[model samples]
Each structure stands twice: as structure tokens, then as C-alpha cells.
Target: MTTLFELFSRQHVYMQEESAPGFAPACLMRVNPDDWGRIAEAARTENCRWVAAWGEDRGDELSVNACFEKEGAYAIARTGVPRAKPVLPSHSPYYAAADRPERHIRDMFGIAFTGHPDTRRWTRHQAWKEGEHPLRREFPADGHPPVPTAPDEHYPFLHAQGGGVYEIPVGPVHAGIIEPGHFRFQAVGETILNLEERLGYTHKGIEKIAEGRDAMALARLAGRVSGDSTVAHAWAACQAMEKAAGMEIPERAEFLRAIMAERERIANHLGDIGAICNDVSFTFAFYQFGRLREVWQRVNHEAYGHRFMMDCIIPGGVTSDMGDQVTVAMEKQITFLRTELEGLYNIIDDLPSLEDRLDTTGYLNPDTARAFGALGYVGRASGMAFDVRKDSPYAPYNRFSMEVPVYQQGDVATRVKVRAEEILASCFLMEKLIDELPAGQIRRDWRIPPSGAEGLGFTEGFRGEIMTYVRFGDNGRIARFFPRDPSWLTWPTLEKCIRDNIVPDFPVCNKSINGSYSGHDL
Candidate 1:
């Protein structure tokens, strides 16, 4: 496999002599503004995945950063432009995944993307005026006491014009307690011709509010990015902070973090499996999985302090240690869960009615999956064989073996099967973590890093790869923080997968993907 440096060097792109401070198995390059698109084109030629892109507002200029990964190696390319007329060529032309993120950067930082296909506002909507960019330093965190804005009914959505095509507009608000996002569909009869999503209704200005916070405060904030992925988010943020501070946590702490992450993965997979079943009217599997999830979460509460295991991962390490009694309880619970899941899976796999509904619904071809760089089970189900734990191991994961379940069917049934297999894989890993529990301090003392320290962190969340970038400002406060959730990549693929499927099958297709609204909105 080619290294990141070799790939860039072969393309004749200039690399900085001194790399950025805190990335491992990854490097940072400060490229000229003119070389930005060239760098993206080079990565695309190498079949690298475009991970994320965001902008930082300096006093006089704006800096844009984009990350790419190839063969377990990561490279961050950054460039700056004048704040007065912040314009940079778009990378979206090379990578489809960069489309919405670049639009988001334009909306948040007032940095224009030259040659971007769709220049309409993404995260902005009607939240702020056209000229106002909330992420700039001059903008207040409270947004000038926040006035109520009128409804955004005039935003243009793509229209399909044909003999029989008509529109179906779904929620920015819905009947359920889920977050707000609008889905616009153009359909002929029951078959969908096209689908477009309008998200960011739950935009919380997370990046703006993250400024100036200390490490601990930031950890707490990261945990709330998506309530369901609390453990994964917190672990990624803390890993970034710890790297910037140049601190090495205890071995025991690493194991504890992995254990919590695996448990979080299992709980979410169980819940998602149940939700998918419910969408297909498979009430038996739905209730069974729901009961299993409740029991799993209760076990989390008994061992950790929270049902979601929030606030348990701090900067230096984790907050709590697992005692012998807690380990015993967890091990016993794992055994019970595994046996029960086997029975449930056997019944669901044999049910012909459930099979008929899910067999080929919501098909996402492998080519589309690769083009969008989808992640987690969504990508795995469609035969994208990239998993952070096995491909880019870290800490406790590096110490043990991992199995990533992948399938090529790319349908609702395949997605459900991937999740089921992953639950079993997580169970195996959690058992190893418990069996090899180390004895030491759970956390170390956190130290303040010098100003201008930068760090990048990556964790394979239950959904997929979670990448976080952090740069420390004066007095060890956060200068810039960006956490790229896996949902950012998966949400767009949902639109592609739903095409040509019936409108009524949308629910199961959606549940099978299960993109997190808050995770993507942030």
C-alpha cells in the first residue's frame, strides 16, 4: 500500500517540511490556495475518501481545511484566503461527499466556494441574514439575544416536471419526538422519481459555542453532540484533547474506554434493529429487540453512572473504573444477551413475510456507496470494507483482533443483517476487554498545552468513523474544534437509496440507515 506522503509527492504537490503537531499515522500539509483543488483531484485519482471540510475565521483571513484518507492513512490539506473576499475553488467537483460540507462552510464562514454546483444555503436557511456569518470571532455566542425568525417557506427545492410526477413534502416537524428535517420527494404513482433532504433545522451552533472552552468543558459538550453516540463522541474529543496536550493515558483507562464504546455500539445496533423491524410491521422482533436494548442500557447504568455512559470519558482518561463486581455483572449480562439474540435472529431470518418486505427494498448499489464514501453499517452492507478498528487500530483495539461484517446485497435485509453480525462482533470484543482488564489508575492529571497546539483524532463509532480536530488558543482554550460525525456521509446516501422504491417503503429504508439528525446538524 502507498503511504500518504508518497501519494502527494507523486502528484508533485508541495509538502511542508514540519508537519502539524498532533496526528499519528496521519500528516498535515499547508497548501497554497491555488493548489487546493489540485490536491483534491490528486486524492481522488488515488481513490482516497474525502473525510470532512470546515472553515476557520481568523481576524484578517479565512482558513479552509479538508481531510482525506487512503489505506488507513490520513492527510489534512489547508489553505487560507482574504476575509474581505474569501473565495476558494470547491473540492466537491472531485468528491461528491464534499458537496454539502462545502456549502455548510460557505453558509457558516461567508467563504464562497467557486465552481460549486448548487450554491444555495445549507445550514444557514433563515437563521441569520445573508451577510452575517455566525462562526466568525466577532459574532456573539448568544446571537444578539436571539429574535424569532419567520418560517423559511421560500427556499427552492428541486422540482420534477413530467406527465405523472407530483411532490410529497414531509416534515421539518413530525408526529414522533425525533428532530426536525424536511424531505421533499417527486414521485410518479407510488414509485419515487427523486428525493432531496433539507436538514440543519436542529443546527445548534455547536462549533461556535465550542470556542474558548477548556478541555473538560469541551468533553462534556462533545458528549451531547448526539445523545445516542455519547460514548463515541466523548472518546474522540478526549482523544484529540489528550493528543494536543501530549499526554499518554493509562493502559487501564484505554481498555475502559473501549469497553464503554463496545457497549454503546451494541445498545445502538439493538435499538436500530428493532426500529427497522417495527418499520416493516415485524412486531415480534421489534418488541424483542426493544426489551434487549432496555436491559443492555440498564446494565450500562449499573456499571457506569449513566444509561448512555455520558461524561465518563475525560481528557486524560476515563472518569470511572470497573470493579471486579461490575465486570462479573457485565460478563453475565453479555452471555444472556448473546443467547437471547441467537433465538431472536433465528425467528426473524425464517419469517417469510418479513423477508418479502425487506429483500430488495431501498437498494444502494456498491458504486454509489463508494462515490459517496458512506460509512458504518450503511457502507458495510453495500460492500465497503473499511473499519477503523481493523484498518487503523488504536489503544486496546490494537491489542486484540476484530471482525468486520460486510455484505454486498445493499438492501434493507442486508443492512439489518450487518447490524446483527456487528452486535455479535462487539460482544466478542467486550468479552476480551473484560478478560484482560488491567490494574492501574483510571485517569491522569490533565496538563495545559502551549498555545497553537493542534491535534486530530479518529474513532470508529457505532455508526462509523468519527474524526475530530482541535487547535488550542491562548491559555489552553480551544481556538477551533470540528467533530465530523459519520452521519454527514450516510445522510446523503439515504436520498440515493430511496430512489425507485415505493413511498410506503421509505420508513424501513430510512430506519435501516438510521442517520442521526443532531449528529449531522452539528
Candidate 2:
């Protein structure tokens, strides 16, 4: 396989070695603002997936970053644009995943993407005045208190014109307890012509809060990025911090970390399975799966003092250890849950009515999935075979066997089947992890590196690959923090999959993709 350095070097980027240890184990380069799009297109043509793109406000220039991955290798192409004229060529024309983040960067840093297709504001939507980038160094975290926020009813949505087309607008608020997001659908009768999503309703200014935070404080904040994804997000943040400081955690802690991630994965898959079933009016299946999920969460609570395994994963190491009895009990619980889950899945799979509802509903083709760089179950169901655990192993994953389930139907049924298969795979992984549970200390002290330390953390959470970037300031405080959640990419595909599908079936389709509103909004 060709290396990342070879790919970028071929594109005439000025290659540079990053001094911060363990940030991203790949070649780094600084590119000219004009060649940013060219360099990005080269990597995309070479089959590299788009990871993330963001902008940092330097005093004199804006640092624009486009992160890409291929063959388990990552490359970061950054360029410094003069602050007075903050303009960079857009990477979105080649990578659809770059579209939202580029708009986000434009909204947050006032850096214009010269050739970006969509120049509309994304993250800021009237919260801040025109041309005021909240992420800039000059913008105070606690800005002057403003007047009551005005209602945003006049968003210019792209309306479809047809013989019988009509518009159906859904939530910035919902009847359910789930988070807020607005959806605009153009449909004729029940057939949808187009679906547009208006997210960022749950935007919490997470990156803004990370400014000047100590390591521990940042960890706490990262853990809450999405409550269900606490373990994965916190782990990614800690990995970045530890790597920057050149700290190595213990083997036992690594094993426990794996256990926490797997548990988090299993819990979410369980809940998602039930939620998906419930959306189809399969009430019995929902109840049964709900019971199984409740039992599974209770086990996590008994084992780690929290149902979702939140805050159990700390920076440098895990906060708790599994005693011998607890280990044995967890092993048994895994077997029981797996068997029960299989039985529950068999019922859903065998039921023709359930199958009819999900089989071809919300089909996302392989071509679309490829173009969007979809991740997690959404990508897997559509035949995209990139899994962070197997593709780019870290900790216990590199030391064990991994099986990533892939399906080609790109339908709701396929998505459901993939989740079912992943639940089984996670069970096997957990058993192996417990069987080889290493014996050693669980905590390590990480020293603060000098100012300007930077690091990157990449991991496969339940939803999919999560990448976090961290750079430190003086006194070990966080300077720049960005969490590129899988939801960021997956949310876009939700619109594509629903195309040409009936409006009423949108709920099941929505549940199948199940993008995290909070994670993406942040």
C-alpha cells in the first residue's frame, strides 16, 4: 500500500513532522491555501475517506485542517490563511462529508471557503451577528448578554416543484423525549421527493467550553457530549490528552477500557433494536428487546456503578477494576444476553410483517454511501467495510480478533440485521477480553507537556468512527478541541436514504440510521 506521505508528496504539499508524540501516527503536511482542494482531491481519488475538516483562529492566519484516512493510515493537510483575507479552497466538491464542517468552520471562524457549493451559515443561525465568529480568540466565552433570541421561522428551504408536490414540516420540537431537530420534506401524496434536515438545535458550544480547561475538566465535558456515547467520547478525549503528554496507561486499564467500550456498544445496539422495532408498531418485540436492554444495563450498573458506563473511563486509565467474582459474573451475563438477544432477533427476523416493513424501506445505495463516507452501522449495511477496531486497531483491539458485520441491501432490514450481528460479535469480543483480562495496575499519572502540545484520538464507538483533536495551551489548559462524531457524517445520509420513500415510513427509516442529534450538533 502507498503511504500517506507518498500521496500528499505527489500532490506537492510541504511535508512536515509533528513533534507531539502519539497525536496521529501518520505523515503530516502543511499545504498552500490554493492547493488545499487539489491535495484533498488526490487523496479522495486514491480512495481515502474524509475524516474531518475544521478551522483554527491564529492571530495572523486561520489554520484550516482537512483530515483523511486510507489503509489504516491518517493524513492531515493544514494551511495557514492570512487572517485579513481568510479564504481557502473547498474540499467539499470531492468529499461530501466535508460540506457540513466547511460550513461550520465558515460559521465559527469567519474563514470563507472560496469554492464551496453551499455558503449558507450552519452552526450560528442568528445566534451571533453577521461576520462574528464565536470560535475566534477575540470572541469572549461569556459574551455580553444579548436580547431575547428571535424565532427562526423564515429559514429558506429548497422547495421542490412538481404536479402534486406538497411540503410537510416536522420538529424543532417532537412529541417524544428525544432531542430537537427540524425536518422539511417535499412529498407528493405519501412519496417523498426530498428531505432536508435542520439540525444544531441542540448545539451546546462544546468546543467553546473546552477553551482553557484543565485535562480533568475537559474529560468531564467530553463525557457529556452525548449521554449514550459517554464512554466512547471520554475515551477518545483522554487518548488525545495522554498521547500529547507521552503517557502510557497500564495493560489492565486498557483491557478495562475495551470492556467499557464494548459494553457501551452492546447497550446501544440493544436499545436501538428495540426502538427500531417500536417504530414499526411491533410492540411485543419492543417490550422484549426493552426488557433485554434493561437487564443488560443493570449488569453494567452492578459492574461499574453506572448503567451507561459513564465516567468510568478516565484519562490515563480506568477508574474501576473488575474483581474476580465480578469478572466471572460478567462473563456469564454476556453468554446469557447473547443467547437472549439471538432469540429475540430470530423472532424479528422471522416475522414476515416486520420484514415487509423494513426490507426495502429507506434504501441507501452503495454509491451514495461511498460518496458521503458514511460510517458505523449505516455504512456497513451499505457495504462500506471500514471499522476503526479492525481497520486501525488500538489497545486490546489490536491484540484480539475482530469481526465487522457488513451487508449490501442498504435497507432498513439490512441495518437491523447488521446491528443484530454486531451484538453477537461484541459478545464474543467481551468474552475474549474477560478471559485474557491482564493483571496489573489500573492507573498511570500523565505529566503535562509544554504549551503547544497537540494530539489526535481515533476510535470506533457504537455509531462508528469518532475522531477528536486536542491542542494544549500554557499551563496544560486546552487550547483547541474538536470532536468529529460519526453522527456528523451519518446525519447527512439520513436525507439521501429517505428519498422516494413514503412519508409515513420516515420514522422507521429515521430510527434505523438513528443519528445522534446532540453529538452532531456539538
Give the number of the best model, judged by lDDT. 1
Question: Which residue runs of candidate 2 sit more than 4 Å off their true CA positions?
Answer: 12-20
lDDT string, candidate 2, 1-522, tens digits: 777868767766556645436555855677767788888778877888889987787678889887889988888778898888888888888998899999999888898887788867788776778868889999988654578656667778888997998999999899989999999999999999999999888878898889999998888898899898999999999998988888889999999999989988988998898889899899887888788888889888888999988888787898899998788888888888877876787798799999889999999999899888999999999999899899999988999878899989999999989988998899889888988998999988768867988888988999999999899999999999999899999999999999999988999999999999999887
- lDDT score for residue 194 of model 1: 95
User: Which lDDT value does model 1 have at 357?
Assistant: 91
Clashing pairs in 2: none
Residue-level lDDT tens digits of model 1 in 77-147: 88899988888989989989999999999988998888789989999888788888899988888775467
TM-scores, all candidates, are 0.99, 0.98
Q: Candidate 1: minimum summed lDDT over ten consecutive residues — where?
A: 15-24
Q: For each candidate, how many residue pairs have backbone atoms clashing (under 3 Å)?
A: 0, 0
The total number of steric clashes, by the backbone 3 Å criterion, in model 2 comes to 0
Clashing pairs in model 1? none
